[model samples]
Target: MALTIGIIGLPQSGKTTLFNSLTKAGAPIGGYATSTVQANLAVVQVPDTRVDALADIFQPQKKTYTTVEFVDVAGMGQASQAAKEKREGLSPEFLGHIRNADALAIVLRTFANDNVTHVYNTIDPNRDLDSLNAELAMTDLATVEKRIERTKKAAKSGDKKYVQEMEFLQRLQETLNELGLASDVEISAQDRVVTDELFLLTLKPRMYVLNTSEDMLGEANEVLAKIEKGEQVVPESLKGELKGIAQVALRARAEGAQVAAVSAKLEAELTELPEEEANEYLEALGLPQLGAERVIQVGYRLLNLITFLTAGEDEVRAWTVTRGAKAPEAAGKIHTDIEKGFIRAEVTHFNDFIECGSFAAATKKGVQRLEGRDYEIKDGDIAHFRFNKGK
Candidate 1:
């Protein structure tokens, strides 16, 4: 499957800069707030050290890593009450791109650049989040209202199905009306069939990207570390410097979303340098890795995904599947024929393989196991499917 994450935010939020840093596509920046007619897209390989290690050991003909596609669309916001009332917050073109994305990477600017203007004339990430939420909720509200109208007309047939659907749509309509996310509303299995078609923006998993200034990068990293450590309370001393970041982080935690802090300007510049030089620069800044990398990593996790490996002299590859995927379903990720003709899977953990040095060694050490159709695939599992293709 090709995973896609939509990059969206208010105007001048450095969303394009962050996109360039993530993809190294060098997309042009500094345009008007809504100037992007078409989304800038790029498929970026998900970096994994395990794939490199397996490649080194097997010396495969080719190494293939799983990838995530990023779509950077125009900034979305018409925050006024009038726009919400008219249901005209998001343009149709923008909706077409974002609605299909598996997840969302919402860029929130905390960077203070005098030359580049902010859409709201001030930087308040929490307020910006509220505005974005309102826009999305309003959009979803329109969708629900239309569905309710149809369901109401359909219910006149005195069918129980339409009445049930009408009730669910009414609940969704009420939730979206109050600016609550559709995701927060309880959805049953039956409701999923209805919600799936609506593609409610508020229901997509999201990661909040705090675009910080270069000078505040260290402070931003420190704050993020604290948040990751479960220190929910922002310290008084560092609060002023990272107020927006801290606020966003807390909100992300409350909503079970992901949060990343990145100096997009610095990271984009680093992308222009040699790899070794870039590493040295990051070390000089006391940063362990690029912020753009963290954003990508978190976005992948937001989709509830896991990576399983396939190793051989012919190819050392990484494949993605949803967490808790059964062996047969994972085999299907390789090929539908494999799933149809499924028998069993020879699986070994990457760590165990490394400890044993090779598949033969792992099997000899009794670390390799044969998994059946009921087996759940785990991250970093080196798998070889045993199937009768002739079947």
Candidate 2:
């Protein structure tokens, strides 16, 4: 199954714009009141220069890249004043869309556009982030409280496991009530089993996406310099905007969340152009790659996943696996039969294989090794498994 990351933010924060840029789906972009009522889902191939290089070397009939699924959820916000008193939690439909997501990309608007109205009627990324976090925390607190109550009832039966679970749930409830993230609390290996079942939003891996103006797409460093030197002294007209983005970066660093700045509008436009034209445009703008690509890569890594490569005359493909996955588990990604056969695997590092120019050459150079099923796969490993047909 493809790993999924959900895009979430306030209305008009560019969540849909980022989704369109990343997936090239051409989803509609609209004002604050025009939020998408339904989630938009797309699977996108992860771009890897190494994959392209290997494909060139092998001249394979087919080349495949690892993919990630992006779900652009509608903007979430406070209930209307009339309904605020009765609003207990997030809408059930919104929870359904986000519950299964492996990670989240919280898009925060930093650019000032008079034409595009902010949900809060102001341009403050930090305030927007806090607002969203509060809602997510409230949702998690509700989940934890319900679990605590149920676990308490079960513990009355004197089951030791239930008692322990009750204690854990209470602790989680306390943390959530304090407005702390579920991910921030440490839990035992055994307790993790229960936490995973809750599917708490605050527990998922998250990153910040700072949506800036097109003029600031590749000028983060320059923008920062101006901000640090004082906006008053800096002649740039967008100094205030740059300062807003810098504040978000600082906040993300303090909170240990990954953050990236992107001009979603620019990237969406670039995606509409042909590949060659896009590359040329990026070159003209002095950008190494699209901001959307960086966001995808960051989101992929945040999920704690790594890619291993397979190269051959027939096919060259990149496969995704958890960071510490063993050889058999990695094989299971391709086929259960391969994993069930349970044999040794021939492994070579990508760089070593590329240097040797061939598997035989790598073997001759003593870089290729026969690894058992217990061997843990590393990122960039080129693997060939040898397994018995009759298992």
Candidate 2 C-alpha error for residue 47, in Å:
1.1
Local error of candidate 2 at residue 365 (angstroms): 2.0
Highest lDDT among the candidates is held by which one? 1
- Per-residue C-alpha lDDT of model 2 across residues 35-104, encoded as one tens digit per residue: 2357889999999888999999989999999888999887878445543344345666778888999989
- In TM-score terms, candidate 2 sits at 0.90
lDDT against the true structure, per candidate, is 0.88, 0.83
| Per-candidate alpha-carbon RMSD to the true structure | 1.7, 3.8
Q: Considering every candidate listed, which one attains the maximal TM-score?
A: 1
Clashing residue pairs in candidate 2 (N, C-alpha, C atoms within 3 angstroms): none
